[model samples]
Target chain A: MESSSNRLFSARDLIGFAVLIAIIFVVLPIALDGFRLNLFGKYLTYAFVAVGLVLCWGMGGILSLGQGVFFGLGGYCMAMFLKLEASTPENTSIQSTPGIPDFMDWNQLTALPAWWEPFNSLFITLIAVILVPVVFAFIIGVAMFRRRVGGVYFAIITQAFAAILTILIIGQQGFTGGVNGITDLRTLKGWDIRSEEAKEILYFVNGGLLIVCLVIAQYVRKSKLGRLLIAMRDQEDRVRFSGYDVASFKIFIFCLGAAFAAVGGAMFTLQVGFMSPTLVGIVPSIEMVIFCAVGGRLSILGAVYGALLVNWAKTSLSESFPELWLLGLGGLFIAVVMVFPNGLAGVYAEHVEPRLMALLGKSKAAAPDSAANETPAE
Target chain B: MFSDYTMNELGAIFAMQGFAGLILFSVFVLMALGLAIIFGQMGVINMAHGEFMILGAYVTYLTSNLFADYLPSVFGLYFFVAMILAFIASGALGLFVEWVMIRHLYKRPLDTLLATWGLSLILQQVYRSVFGAREVGVSIPDWMMGSLPMTDMIEVPINGIFVMVLATGISLAVYFMMYRSSWGLQVRAISQNRMMADAVGINTAWTDRLTFGIGCGVAGVAGSAFTMIGSTGPTAGQLYIVDTFLVVVFGGAASLLGTIASAFSISQAQSIMEFFLSGSMAKVLTLLTVVGILMIRPQGLFTLKLRK
Candidate 1:
């Protein structure tokens, strides 16, 4: 009983969770103003995708370079809903088409397309945000995994999907708001999202949802399924011979990751007040993978911090020294892969966690299955 | 779409579109050859491949300027010199990248992808800094400027023809090098069984470097050809990277013939579709079909019948 309880949440794990929670819910809100907090909220949305990557890439050894597709889909779904609400006939009376989106009107679309009709309902839009990406991922996962296509092949294929989606979005401008994406999302069910108070509420809501996701991730990590994922990553043939349906597990995790990214996308639309093809393309998609890598793919908590740190750096560095930002980012990619393959989580496990244990007078034997000792050098 | 044109005009359009496709096919083949050599032979995905090609383009641009300024009498022949220089410059860089970054990550193919992508980013920034972030075009010599009047309605650009000829020559050369040369024999052996090749007295490490350098050299040559058709920019290479990758993957890895065939088919499909559909739609459709087909036949259009 004690072992099982410890497996679910070791003392160290609990401490890590508490610290992360405090940082997100307590410290960040106190330290920054509403505007900066909103910006951090935007960054935290990326953490959702990063956390999903931890499960898919880190644990399952499935590196999807197209998480942005799911993110974009989710954002678009939410954006479509908001755009529909904002495009009430009275609001869009100046346009030739008074009931449809302005972009659609510009493109000379007389009416809302049948597909866009469902997004009118918030409940339907919310559900579609998750379902669309999961369905897309399910199709991709099934197609690739069943054929036993994986590793670099899977990564490239996912990237192609990102490219395809981007082109489709940009090409079908009338329907998808073109390359500009669904923008000028003013409200959410008539609650002015652009206002300070609403942004603050959305941030806390985003933070709460993120905490729920982290706990769910932790539960999965401590489960037998998580052990199976690690084993499958290391030795696929052995796992297959052991009577497990490897493809199904891969499909499940990929879908879950897609779903997480979708939620992040929805939150992003709410916070950033727009969705654009820039967020759905190859560059952003690959950047999302780097976030997972930087966070230490093995740790969900690390993914959040990784997302925050990398994004913060990107925002500040680009704002100050645009020329140096790409160089720094490029260097970070090399350093993360070459020097610190385990990322912040690995570093913490190796350097910080052990020292913390020592400072607290705890025996090292108490945490035999710590992530650091088990991380096979890839 | 066909209803708009008479039969004679339709035939002319088809002929014109076919020629356009052939030019695109040349570009695809050139880019895919280098990528195929690297990915197929070494099992390394160099995302920086497009950047290498752009490096070749920048070299060509510089060479054109040099010839026009200093060697006015030999301006027409500067292209030949530029191609060779591009090969050397890009090849040398590939060799260095392999030594510094790729060598350590040989055991990790995915990590190689990330590292090379970083290399690509750095290379892009370097190009932006050096070239002022603007698209640079090379001046075409007088001999390469005219179009051949193939028909009343159809004319062939001399540069397009030149690029095609160059692509064909490079393809044949690569085919011979891969199939007939002793270095090619060592590369195939190493790719097939590294341990056996090493035990049989081959310098596997040096061979790997040479293979990578040659692959990148081929990309540089492709880039040299590219400057004839398009402008060179820091980010232009990225646009081609995905298409080039799809071409290589669609053609099975490890098969030069497959790469050529796949590139030809994809380029033709895309070019022909571009006439009837919007360019972006054509691209999306072409990519979708390729990806859909890839899903069904994961081994690609061709596969090596190797005994594992």
Candidate 2:
């Protein structure tokens, strides 16, 4: 039992987790005002996707560029429930179809669509928020990984899915709120979500959920399955020769990544008040990958910071110099791929952690060595 | 929907939509041919290929203005000059990008995708800054305007015919350059076995740069043709990038014949469906079908069987 506990959380990992918890649950909330905290909360939602990418892309070598689809699926699921709740006959009495969402009424839908029937219940919607994307990922994973389609091909195909989903969403605007997306989400279970206090509460809730996801990701990373993933990434044929069902592992990780992105998407809808086709497109999907890439794809904790830093940079930079932001982002993508493939975690392990260890005067050499060794020698 | 139209009217609509699909097919062929050469032969995913094409379009835009302002008498011939200039401009940039960015990433195809995506974003911004954010249209030569009358009800735009001709000419040229030329032989040799090709005294690096250049040059000409059908914007290239990638992949990445066949099928399917459904729905259905087919046949419609 002691060995298992140690395997799950080493001294170094515990320290990392504690720092992350303080930063998310304490530091940011104490330092920033409500508005800024809400913005950070939105950014944290993306960290969910980034963490999932660490498991799928960084560890499993499955570079899915269409994570936005899962994110959108999750968001839309939440949005559907919220829209349904907000469309109580009393609330939507102004519309011709009183109990249906305003967008549906406007689109001439006389009744709620049969497929949307399940989302009327929060319990089902919550389940669907995770289940829908996982199922989609499962289908894609079984189709591609089972056939041994991977690397650049997998990336391109996933991107194509993003495009297809975006087009489908936009084209079925009457059914999907069109380009405007599902809007005017008022309350969740009679709670006023638009209030400042509610916003702060949601921010905390998002942070808590993100921490939970990070722990789950870390647990996966520490397991024997994690070692197998690394081996498969490095040599698929050899792992297959060793009688491991490589496709099953790949599918499992992909589905888990989908679930993470879905949760983030649902949180985004709750906090941001709407979900749109824009979030489900190719561009946003690839940008999510960059968040993972910037974080150090291999590190779950780093994924959170990566999402925060890049998004904070984006919000501030694009606000000031819109054109320069694209140029800067473009440069970031190139530099990340070329100069620092391992990202922030790599830099930390290589340059910062060692000095800190020396400063602490702890002669426990194995910890720092293991941390350094984890950085791929590419 | 079919019951509304008489047989003769339906025939004319089919002809018109088929012609539209043919024009779309030409564009896909032009774009995918360049990508096939770069991605198929080189094994590098140049996400900035669309930007390279847009570079050609911008060059054409400049050339047209130059002719209309300084030498109105020779304005009719400016398009030919623009095509050559666009090819050189884009091809030179391709060569430079290959040397500076791509060569280092040859062993990492996925990294090349990200880097080229960055290159694309930078190029888009540069275009936005230089050309302004709004899309720019090239004024067509007088001879290329109006329509070519076919049957009593069927008339095709002259510019569409011009783009089709250009696409056909370029496709043939690419086929010859890739298959019949010694340079093509050297490229094939390298793609098959790089170390062995290098050992046999081939200048692999220079050949790679030149091959990348020619691919971009063809994309330049595609951009030149593109101006005939639609306006060019800074982000216009992005709108085509996904579709172009799908075309190349669907055709089997390495086979030029496969690219053409896939382009033809996809374009025809999309245009025909567009007549019946909303444009966006048609696009979604077509793409969904392609992706579904791809899932079933991951190697694509045609593949070069090479030993591991």
Candidate 3:
């Protein structure tokens, strides 16, 4: 694993990471205004989910369409804490139950639900933001993978989970914020999130967190486990025959994806100032998959760019000609799958990177090395 | 919950709920039949299935309006014409889609899912642009309107019975076509062993196109049937996509009988639960149960054993 990790990180990998860091941390902030920067921040949050998909769907070949379920769980956990902080007795004096959330009051509840009580403490909420989704993913992963469910069956079942979670959230309106979601989230422990300064700060926080996660994702990809995941993906029965507990590896990768998505969801709440059932549903989950696909399913860095590019396109296209956005996205999906199955990363690796490497004789040695390793993936 | 009602009232409630369940079952069966054929036979996901259904529904809508405006005296006969037209319109589009898109994705099942999802999104936008965002309803003929009163307290809508009959007729027709015809034999042969079927002089590609077309045409008919019980909208098809998929998967993807049986059980479970709980909760429970069962039995309820 160490030798493989060392071999995986060429000077090219460092250059890629450096460029990504500079763009997110330096270039984007300097170029865009606060509003657009904030929107990019929101998009970056989704990049978290895409990066996770690279690990789970791209590397491991386990596509969980219900990543939104984990994202929603994490976001809601954070939002609950924020909501509780905002609903201080003095803040909600107009309500019948002053200390409780306005929705709970509107629904005629005098006391907070036991489940929500834990979220009042920010530490517990933070832990829960990551823990809850990972736990849920563990249960789902254990059940399905242990029973040898993979491919289309696994995809459909995860989608069904997304459907179930959405309905549950919408149905349990009082507790989960229903269709409108938890709104009016003003402060995070006396620091107002609504301010411009806070938004910029949260953007940096999001960018920084993303880099850290990217490092972790790259580490996983370079690890023996990563190669094992690829092996299992290409030939599951062969991997299982060679003394590997395939289901355990699958469960671990799935839980890891859920944790990443959960963190992203929490950051989404912080930066966006609200979390809703809308983010936790089937549509958003599938959209997240497209982000991974468009970026280059197999490339971690490409996924981040993919998320930003897709969301940016979505915001711009839907803003001008709302009807055309769906058409465009649909067309993009077809183009991505039919024409460029490897996505942006694949294009870069095949076309752009090779040309660049040929221009710079230094890259010639590493090119053949990576090309040998990626033959199976091709 | 039972203690709240008197014995007679409880009996009436059960009967009423059971009848409602039957209507839901008809809908599931109608939708799932087409899905089972496409998914089970050809191994294409066809996420745009609901859109195809909506195509049939829009055709029905157009046919109904045409009858009211140009053939008022023969309006009662417009439905049969609409069903036929819906079938043709949807089948043609399905065939076109198969040729252009689905043919390219035979080796990659997961990519097919994503590609078809893209197709569904495009179809949804097309429908939205053409039909507008609002839900539209087709007017039923005079004979299809009103209800049949079985008892003083338990009355069933005539349209519910009509949908049931339509579902049954289509199911039987599909069964006969798939089991009792040479085309069905060809389809079965292709599904069982494509290379052998090709070597034996069956045109595999043509059969695939027709099978896809017929599957989508059945969905069109199902959508036509849907206009009886619910309104039509561009995204209405999305609401039922997961449920229909579950029905097909739960029934054992390749077996038509399994599809019907799974639809029956799911719809009944959902409708009965709806009587005692909120609609969304009932739906959540039903879907959760199906998913849980599927995790344990991933092959579905009725699997046909095949060589690897």
lDDT of each: 0.92, 0.92, 0.91
Candidate 3: tens digits of C-alpha lDDT, residues B229-249: 889999999888999999999
Worst 10 residues of 2 chain B by lDDT: B299-308
lDDT string, candidate 2, A248-325, tens digits? 999999999999999999999999999999999989999999898898989999899999999999999999999899
How many collisions per candidate?
0, 1, 0
What DockQ do the predictions score, one after another?
A: 0.78, 0.76, 0.71
The DockQ ranking, best first, is 1, 2, 3
Better TM-score candidate (1, 3): 1
**Which pairs of residues have clashing backbones in candidate 2?**
A173-A178
TM-score of each: 0.98, 0.98, 0.98
lDDT of 3: 0.91
TM-score of chain B of each: 0.99, 0.98, 0.98
Q: Candidate 3, residues A351-372: lDDT per residue as tens digits?
A: 8887887787755544553552
lDDT of 1 by residue, A240-313 (tens): 99999999999999999999999999999999899999999999999999998899988899999999999999
> Among all windows of ten consecutive residues in candidate 1 chain B, which has the lowest summed lDDT?
B103-112
Candidate 3: which docking quality band? medium
